[model samples]
Target: MKPAILFSFTIFISAFLLFFVQPLAGRMLLPTFGGSAIVWNASMMFFQALLLLGYIYAHFSIKRLGAKNQSKLHIALMIAAAVFLPLSIAPEAPQWDASPALFVIQTLLVSIGLPFFVLSASAPMLQSWYFSSDAPDAEDPYWLYVASNIGSLLALLTYPFLIEPFLSINEQKWVWTGGYALLVLSVFGASFFVKKAPAAEVTATAQTSSSWAERGLWTLLAFVPSSALLGYTAHITTDISAIPLFWVVPLALYMLSFVIVFARRQWIPSSVWVWLAFAALVPSAYAILLALLEPVGLLLGIQLFSLFTLSVAFHAILVDRKPSASNLTDFYVWMSVGGMLGGVFNTLVAPAIFDRMYELPITLALAFLLLSMHLPRPKFEPPSVSIGKAVRAKGMQTAFSVLVLATAAVGFVTYMQSVDEVFEFTNTMLLIGILTPFALWFVHPILAGFAAATVCMVLPMGYQHQNILMQMRSPYAIHEVREFSSSVGQFHSLYHGRIQHGVQATHPELSRLPLSYYHTSSPIGEVMAIREDFYDVTPVAVLGLGIGTMATYVRPGMEMTFFEIDPQIEKIARDAEYFTYLERCGEQCKVVLGDARLSLQEQPKGKYGLLVLDAYSSDAVPVHLLSKEAIELYMSLLRPGGYMLFHVSNRYVNVRQIVVNTAAELGYVSYFQDHWPRETKLEELMVNSSEWVMVGRNKKDLELQIFDPRWEEQEPDGRPAWTDDWANLWVYMAW
Candidate 1:
């Protein structure tokens, strides 16, 4: 068989096996990590970094060796890496409360490290090697490059459909182990062609080694797109329900872009997609803003699709510019550097630098700049333009500018007026939507894409039901909004994931009443009303005030303090007037701002019968809150034998297991309750639903009294409670 054909097929299988394992391993860790974007990004960073090291190693190691020596080294490494096969690594489950970034990096290193490094570099290493030895007439390893990407794309698409539902986490791990073994054998067979002779003479290739400048360019091209993909994923998941398979679509589309860009036949040229990407950027940004401003479900979905399409287009542009086969290893190594750089930027840097969603726009601008740099340099010939055409172009430009400013103004007004009752938002958005087409007329498609996207951003904020109840933007975000439907006198409230971690009912009456988690069915409600001669509501401190759902538990004279991360949620609730938990509860609802866990640490010692922690309204619970240190803080704020209610309802994992394990470690008597409130009442104007709460109490007479029919008396074999240092996600992956 021809060397290139064999080489391409070999690399294809290796790439397929390599990427197939990524999502599988990521899925296995999801329940414990809560499917946070950080988990995926951080893991990618580790893989990329390791791949970068491999490429550098291969580039340096192969330079002095003959073709035969290269084969020997490749086989030896592949065989050495095979020891990790049957792919079992120690410490299978992760401790949920540990630093996810650190934990993901550490875990991936031990379990899949050697094999993953070998796999990640195989495509580039083999391509470069074949180009050097079997060179005279072989096709540019670039076509074979397309095959590698196609394999990656197929692997990503296959996992969610073929692997996830059919197999349990351990089963998937074992399945991948079998594939890894086969991949090694295939790679070994392909190594024989390394020393094959070429049939025809050829043109000169790029230098076998990459220079510093070339490496720098590779880093630039790679880092930005990687960061952009990660940032977009993070932005979406932070505000929406974090369901399973969220990252798969984005990554699958990203890999598919390679099929379009690098294939032997061009399906979509770089020119058309570059224009599409440009067109998409402004609108995508605007759509996200509209989704954020108005809080509409359909709008958010549209925004996500738009962003995904544009991100794929942008990444495809990078694949089009990849280095020649001679520098293939160096190219991938730098790409890994870029991936690492992007990871650091998104996970650690952006959060610390920006307070709002500024990273989205910054990334858009960065993507635009990179595209602009890649455009062919203009000719030095004299510029030519008809007088009439120039005039028309100038007029169009002015009109486009006018429309953008006008739309931006409309957007600013909507955002500012979101907290004001007198402003008619729907009327404003209607006007903006009407003015949209005029902005696009006579404008370039790229610019028009921005304008159209801006239109999407501006028009949605004025929709009638866009009543955002609560929005908070902190290091840890939480945005809880309520959509009002007076037809049934119902209000629908949703927890906007991390964007709004804690909620203070902005509604006047509902502010003090425990509404969300503290509704009538929860153990907190029973304990508050019946007190059972055991608990009361005096001097109550609630860690997370989600829609002020727990405020209903507060009596006329009770003092309730709410700690919230986002101020926007508080402002929205104040203006919406629909949620009355705070309004009806009187002057006793005091809203505290900052991280709830940190806020609790600062509060003075106080004796309270009820210390409610309603932090887990959504599935993505803050890791810090579940730690041993955090439990101690909750205990510190409670009086002896105080009834502490924790909200534990989630769609992602069995929350009761973690809470049960946590409570057992702390020696607190804990009980679980399933609270699935009717969706109708949650949407009604006045009907407030309660959360299913798990109640835990301090020991009586220095003895742990395990009660409540919902719990089992068995202890957890003394597994230590999660602390900042010892927490790992693998601990909870047993689910």
Candidate 2:
């Protein structure tokens, strides 16, 4: 094969393997971390840091070693990395008791670190090698970057849609390992081509002429988009589910930006993209405030589009400022450094310092600053009267600034008056807020960007602050217990990110009633009530302990075990100040703190009469708990005719089919109950709609009168059963 084709193939395959491993590995670790979106962010940071190391290696090799020697060393490293392949987490992988973020990083490093590092280096190293070759395309090796991004885009898009749905996790890992071996051969072949026709020597002056400022500009350009990717990702996933498919959207768009910006013929012109980005900034800023109020699909579209425009605009600037081939590696090294810094800030620093998601605004402001720097200075055809025009412009700028400040002040005051009151005018205020930033752009782009960011970040925070009684940030999630007053009564709610996990009425009389999803009229409640009739002093095991709400069902002499993954959540739920569910139950309940799947494994067989899996945060359901292996485990812990109940209630995903399919595979009968309560005074006591799936060993066990018409026996409809090996949340997305 020709050198150009060989080089392109190597870059493509390397990127394919690199991106493929990301979602694959993240999916594997999801259950371990309780399916928090933070896992994806932490994974992204680890991969980016490794990419930087890989780039540093590539840069050092080209500068310090001869072509033949560099090729030989890289090949040897590839072989060494291959030894760690067929990747699987070690048996002693850190448990939830350890610092989850630190453990996740350590696990990735031990499992796939070396192989990923080698793949990360492949694109830059191959390009450098090609630049030193006699191939006609060597001088302009940048197009290979477009190829690399395309391959990356393909991997990300395919994983959720095709690869994940069809292949088991182990199967995916082996396929990637096989691809890595082939990539090694391709690299060797390309190296042979390089040896036959080597690059001409570069002058010392050519290597040292580039200024530090130029490098800094490159780093800044790369930094804004890289950081924005994670910021946008967290913002979206926090509100929606933290499934791999949602994670894929922002990343795929980020890669698409590179493909468009670095292509030989630009898909979107720089001039057009600059304006598109500016226009997008307003709506994106407005959308932040509307994340909870608006439909998720619309909000998601706004965020993703904003991310795409900003990325393209910044990346275009990076491409335009590219240095000659002699300085290519240096340019990439700085770019990698910027990317790494962005990941570090988004994954590590922001979560540590900020109470809320302040990274989005910070990144937006920085993106605007970089964009302003890159845009051409506004031209003014000689003014008719320079002094008068300048005076008018100054006056307008002052008026606009005052208006913006006054709007912010009013919004803040209204928020302080009542948090729920702010939502009444949020849409109107958001529109004005969106326009204010665009108007300020003409007066001062820097201030405009920051003002836009402040509107997006600070105003929403003000609203959150009003009703939030307590807020805590853990590596797993941002937890908030908020208070709301309605006609029914005042209620205290537990929120994981923006999704309300559990709610309890503040009135002493109503405090014991399960409010959200688990209300007496709901499916899970019906099942629990039926179990009471069938078994005296029934033993129950609840997978999630959100506010310990399920403890309300504990009667005298009844035994209940609560398994929760997040220690912070357990602490909050057990605290009588925040919730009384646990305290109200007296000695009937016990709490087990760990990943429910791992913790459940230690339980005695035939122990519980009913098992309830109510562990869901927003739509961020722990997939591991829903897998075939988990079902079997739950079955093992239950008595012969014992039933298992799953809370499949979610805004984004309909998990009824997944539950039905998994149950059928084990010859267990399944019944789905979807409850939509009326808007009457009594019904208002319940927070929202509920969906539950109950599985039993014998069909007669689920033949209770309450489970008759409402609890329909569902057919799988050819949907693949979810197992520890394979599952895709995308397959069950309600949208």
Q: Among these predicted structures, which one has the highest lDDT? A: 2
Off by over 4 Å in 1: 1-5, 20-44, 64-68, 88-108, 133-137, 158-170, 196-218, 240-242, 292-305, 372-512, 521-524, 527-687, 690-735
Cα error, residue 358 of model 2, in Å, equals: 1.6
User: In order, what is each prediction's RMSD in angstroms?
Assistant: 9.1, 3.7
**Compared with the true structure, what per-residue lDDT tens digits does model 1 show for residues 664-725?**
77777665555445666443333333334344553452122234453334345444455533
Q: List, residue by residue over 1-735, the lDDT tens digit for candidate 2.
A: 888788888999999999899878877776555454445666777888888899989888877784567899999999999889898876563565667667788989998998999898877788888887789867777778887888898987887788887888999999998999999999989888665232325644344546999999889888889999988888788765455357777888899899988888876678778778867867786556544536767777778899999988888878888987767788899988888888888878887887667788778866666565554444445657688887787788769776976775665466446557567675455456567756676666666666666665555565555677987776677789988877788888899766677888888999989878888787767766764556542788998888988888887888898988677888888778878898888788899876788788878999998899876535555688888888999999988778888887766777777888988988888888878887676456746788888888877766663356887887667877788778877877877
Q: What's the distance in Å from true for residue 659, model 2?
A: 2.2
Pairs of colliding residues, candidate 2: 132-199
For model 1, the run of ten residues with the poorest summed lDDT: 196-205
CA shift at 660, candidate 1, in angstroms? 14
